[model samples]
Target: MSPAGAQPIRAKSRHHRLQEHVLETTTSASLLSTSYLATSPIAQQILARDLAECSDDDEDEVKFDSEDDGDDNDDSEEDFSTTLHGGAAAHLISRPSGTIYGTLRPIIASQVQGSPAVNERDLAQSRREERSLLRDNHILPPKHRRPFRESALRQLYRRIFSTKVHESGCDSDVGKALESSPLLQHDYLSEDASGPPSPSPSETDVLWDCATVASSNILKTTWQREAKTLAQYSGPLILTFLLHYSVQITSIFTVGRIGRKELGAVSLAAMTSNVTCYCVIQGLSTCLDTLAAQAFGSGHKKLVGLQLQRLTYMLWLLLIPIATLWWFAGRILANIIPDQDTAALAGLYLRVLILGTPGVAAFESGKRFVQAQGLFHATTYVLIIGATLNVLANWFFVFKLEFGFLGAACAVVFTQNLLPFLLFLYVRFIDGMECWNGLTRKAFTNWGQMIRLALPGMIMVLAQYFAFEVLTLAASRFGSADLAAQSILVTCTSTTFNIPFPLSIAASTRVANLIGAKLTDAARTSAKVALFAGCLVGLFNMTLLSSLRFQLPYLFTRDDEVAAIVSRVLPICAAMQLCDSAAAISHGLLRGIGRQRIGSYTNLCSYYLVALPISFATGWVLGWKLEGLWFGVTIGLCV
Candidate 1:
């Protein structure tokens, strides 16, 4: 009070000390006491001055908070500083405080000087920054994110749909969605929690992808499958006809060497056996082949084996009746062939051939199963084997053993019957598959399905074979030379049509399986390829037949009269080859589509209603003779 000019050094010193204390205190402690420290530093000084000014006019005494535990180290420091400035030497040292004192001291100081308010604001700012960082890092809330993810998926589906990728499979839109978002993986590896990613595609998958060209390219381009199909089927068709030609030439040759009686018996026996057996064998084989194709395509190997077993039982049972009838074929032949002497000759051939019925039936079953695997080349090999055996056996029995017509029938029996057994054993052991698992009671129960598939084609085959046989019988009445010439021409026509038959079969199997397996693109491509293959085969055979017209007569006859007659009627035969080739291929295509009934009906209408009547009329009433009958066949074929 005496040092008037010194002017409030005490207040200034207090302010300076307060700032230094605050700077040293932790912001964590300040925040804990933020509620109690709402005033600014300068405002607290004004409040203290006001309290001092009010001391003179106070009626009541000021209350001191004696409860303050006397633990104010900061306040003591201020007092000691004040005393030093007043020319007194005083020193104070602080003792270490207890836990409560340490905790509360900073809190109390923060409240007195508004340090808590600054700390509270900093803490709030820190909380906001944390939230912003999380948002920036893609840790979005469930409600705000799910719809966005779903929208992205929907857009992806739309893009695939627009690109025509959905045409690749059945319910393709769904498949595409599943492919993108694999549900099966969800159970094993949760997408929500972080984990390692999926590995790269496998070698097989990569190869398949690389090989899979666009559907457009597959449709336009011809593949080796088609070329192989042409080679495989065309050869068999030609061979079937060639075999028929061999029968006719053998008849004429035998007649020239032996007599008409012996030749007639052999020719009738060959025709009766080949036509009847060929229909049953091919029909059943087609059904079996189609089944195998479906099973293979769908990856149902076990089911295929089971179905094959069923077919085996059904085939064996069916053969029982056929075999029994053929066993008594010697007696039946007396009425079928033209003369009693020819009947005796034909009966001997039939008796020997009938011995091979079981073998032939089994062989056909095995062949169908193999061919169904799209191994069209198998047909060529099997045919070659049979042909070789037949040729060798014929030479041995006829020329060496002097077995006559019985020798030829024995050759047919030995070769045809043995082939299927060898093929079955090879396919089962070497190829490691059971194409013929044999008959069981379980197979019989499933035979209804097999019969459902087999019957239409079987009936169609029977009708066609019967019509051809009747036409041959009628032509035989025109004279032996006319019969021989007609046989050669018919054989040529039949062989050419056979080439496209397998192509049709492959198409049916592939398309049906692809459709069943939900591979729409593959199915469509298979159908187109088959159709193209059919057309190409027809065109090629037509070209071949046209070029070979002059040489056709030399194959079957040395007689100038027969050659001249064949040359006169060759145009109709050529036309029949063209028409029949297309028809046979188309018929096969229809069968592949499981539309065998439609093909059967088409055959019925083409052959019976049209071909037969015209053939009879031209041969019998019109007096056009063999040319007229062939012309009727040509017109009937067009119909």
Candidate 2:
């Protein structure tokens, strides 16, 4: 064969390879546009540019082969091929007479022949044209054209739940899909490598947005899978929350048996301790959800221990003031309460509780530390032992030893202190020791970040807790019968809350994990399942409370008046269960989306602005008493 004859055959082979490459690229772009590119301006621009380049090449091929073809029929076939392969590109190419592809193709080709500087200039020009095309097409919004300034919180979340961790796992179908997706890999790598220009911050945002959207659509998660995950998480969590709650309720059961005064006093003391101390401890330790979990997830194992220590120290220091308040609480209660005897007994219970404050602090912080390392069962184990001990101690001290109301307080104090010790033994002897560094001086330093996160959490918790405690205080104004009945209502509602609250936490965990994995649709699906589960739990609680309304009060108190008042108000409390569960689960959903501030604001406004005023008006002003107070609470939960 002559050299001229050889040229056409090589050209034909090159044409076939280019055609195949163009076909694949076109298919990929179509799939991407359908699933992901809709959210990504930068990706859309790149695909458009590639199509335009292919169109230009086809036009050049047509021009070159036009003279060789004898018939008009061959020219028409070439035109149809051009339109079929790059219809959008043909339209785009025709609109821009001086398209970047027309000018840069020669330079890009020449760069393979070693003209580096001209190729660099041509590449820069190509980028500018891409941006212009993006803007003209209205693909990139003007506001988003500027550098995307990520919020500090979002940046921190990304850093904590980085793609490196997900890539390492590749556990789920979604993870495997992400790992296997060459289109996504190419888009991500192109920005990092020297071949393509790095994307601007806005473009970077668009790229990730595309990936997330595409992954969510392509890898659809089933409702059954989400429900199973929720069940796994919530089952143990429900038991743990219930057992932990039972520690206080045990004291109520023992103390309530003595008399109506003791029952009201126990309720008053429990409310006071919870609002002033336990809620603060829980809230401050909430920082560990982010801090300790981030540290553990990022593989800084010892930082988890340091966080725990710092939070524990903060709590112990805060305890000094809390203990003082409890010691003098009797005098404070005496001035406020209509019944001096009940106030004195309540204050005595608070004073006894002061001994257990440090233990509560340690346990709360330690619980988070272990949970951050995925050691959820450790707390459950400790609570099982602690709750059982509390029950037996309550029975022995109050009944066997005949120590009266103070014995229930003693039993509570013993259990509260014992819990941290039990948790410590588990951590030291069991699974979570890897994250525990020995007590260090570093724990005392760098308190600012922890405190900053803690204060807002504390305030949010206080808002919710204080709202309920205020209802307890308001019921006191109605006298011992109403207050004791209020205690039963609060206990029943709180016990039922344990079911849905834990379910919500489970749902939140599932949702947050899905969001981190960029499974947006899956996260949304999980949230819906959680809400549905919450509704079911709420219905169960409602049925139980309403059906056993008369009998349920006798379990707490033998007093005829208290039981009568409780029976009258029990149905109202049962009616609030659905609303209560929905509210708790909704808050969990908000937390999952990193929009907990919205939940906090809503809680504050609904409880304070909506619920309390109505309670005050109906309970006191309209003489509806306990029933009206709960009606207000029900209204608040609805909001």
Candidate 3:
């Protein structure tokens, strides 16, 4: 077929056959069915250019054929096919009869061959159809819309005042915003004309259904109902269980590191710092929880801002006393421990812990505010951040910093302070809620509410602290070892008993909100749920601690004498959880009803007037050592 001396092409040699096979495999599938993809308007132009490259040599022939046909329709078909293979023509030769060209085959031939154009067209068309369907279904378009800042602000106002507009509206920004909002807009009718009547029955029913759906959406994933709320109790219970075990282990390990005097000092400092902070934060934060929950449940939006402002006032007031005490805690430590060195260390611990007070309190407030809006996951994340910081700081300070008790103290402060600041910042900037402005200027007005909430709770905590101090003194008369063992046992209890803290917290808010909204049945259901859950958690903790009784003392000491004494008292520790759980849950329920005074009185009677004296009498007068003392305290716990 060539000019001169060229033989006709024949079958390939073995090597040639291999070469052909390799080329066929190497050719891309994309090039084979490209014509089919060209049906898309965007792809159609691309196909035309590719087809021109394929028919470059036959362009004149095509031009002549087009002229003879005297029709422009054939020219378009020629352009399309030629454009489709433009990139492939340098290497590909068209098969005379088949759709495929030289050295190439379709990868998905069966899928494309019957109606290759239809196959690709359908795929492209399907995507368009889907987009069209979405639009037709009334989906919001993906266009930038103006921020509804004023609307959000107004809504926030309505949340606080709920459109009541009592007291004839004051000159305050909140009052002004409330009065100007469309929610409060009620057009007056002219004397000559009457206004339209309200909606008919069918319209009312439709509105009711819409409202119900919206309510259901808010409650769907939340622990709001009887079944779901109760089900949620199990997770927090298990998490608390794990945390308690870890805390107990940590206390025992810490006490085991040094002597009894050191152990007692550290334990006292730790308990005082933690419980004080807990009382301060929780007590002040309770108001936010109550306010936020009421605001949310009743659909009063601006109340969130007011609640936060009120909490801020309480926090600032409490901060002064706490900060002052912390600054001078070392001087005061002398009276408690009677050892200059131990007292100094306790004072240092107090000072270190105080550094985190503001942050910790703020964090607690933010958490309660978010949680009252039904954000459980926010609480979960806050705990996770605090716990992670706590563990990391403990490891670094104790092991790497080599600061011992001081390091542990610093670690606690670091976590407590950091989490609050972070949470507060997040709530302000990123939470996207308009009411976040409450953290700004409005926080000054709610001082009265915060003080009222903080005073009782702080006093109660301080009383508990004093009671522990007396017990420490009583235990000290038995010698340093007895004091050390008692300190370790208390740490173990702290860890174990903390398992119900979250449950109590959840119960307090859940039940309180329902009660506030007059959902008596729901409130009762939540109480039962919390009670059953707390009992199960308490039982589980009891079983776990009892099972590990023998090894517990060893974890806290290498001294055989001290370990033996502690091991004997392990049974008493096991029984204490039962009383602790009942009291803790009862406190929670009472707290929900704003009866914290009841909780304060109960703690005073049980620990101060009862447990301390019994411990001293049995350990000293009865000559039974630490075991007898613990047994008496357990009996006091029971009463």
> Could you report the Cα RMSD, in angstroms, for every candidate shown?
38.8, 23.3, 30.5
Q: 1-639 in candidate 3: lDDT tens per residue? A: 111321111111322332343234322111222211112221122212222332343222222121345656443333222232333211111111011100000001110111011122332332332222212211212122234465877777645533121223312332233234343223211111233333332332222222222222111111233334444543554463454234324533653675555676675565556455555565445445434543332233344655665575667667888788778877876776556666676677778777777766666667666655444444455555656566777778877878877776676667767766766666666662644433444445435434553465445434545555555566655655666677767666766666665456556645654443333454676688678777887788788778888887777777676666677777778887777676666666765666656666666677667887787778778888777777776877687
Q: How does model 2 fare in lDDT?
A: 0.63
Clash pairs, candidate 2, are: none
- Model 1, 48-113: lDDT tens digits are 332244335433222222223475643643321222123111011000000000010010000011
Candidate 2 lands at a TM-score of: 0.66
Give the Cα lDDT of each candidate.
0.47, 0.63, 0.49
Cα lDDT for residue 368, model 3? 60
TM-score of each: 0.55, 0.66, 0.55
lDDT of 2 at 169: 31
Better of 1 and 2 by lDDT: 2
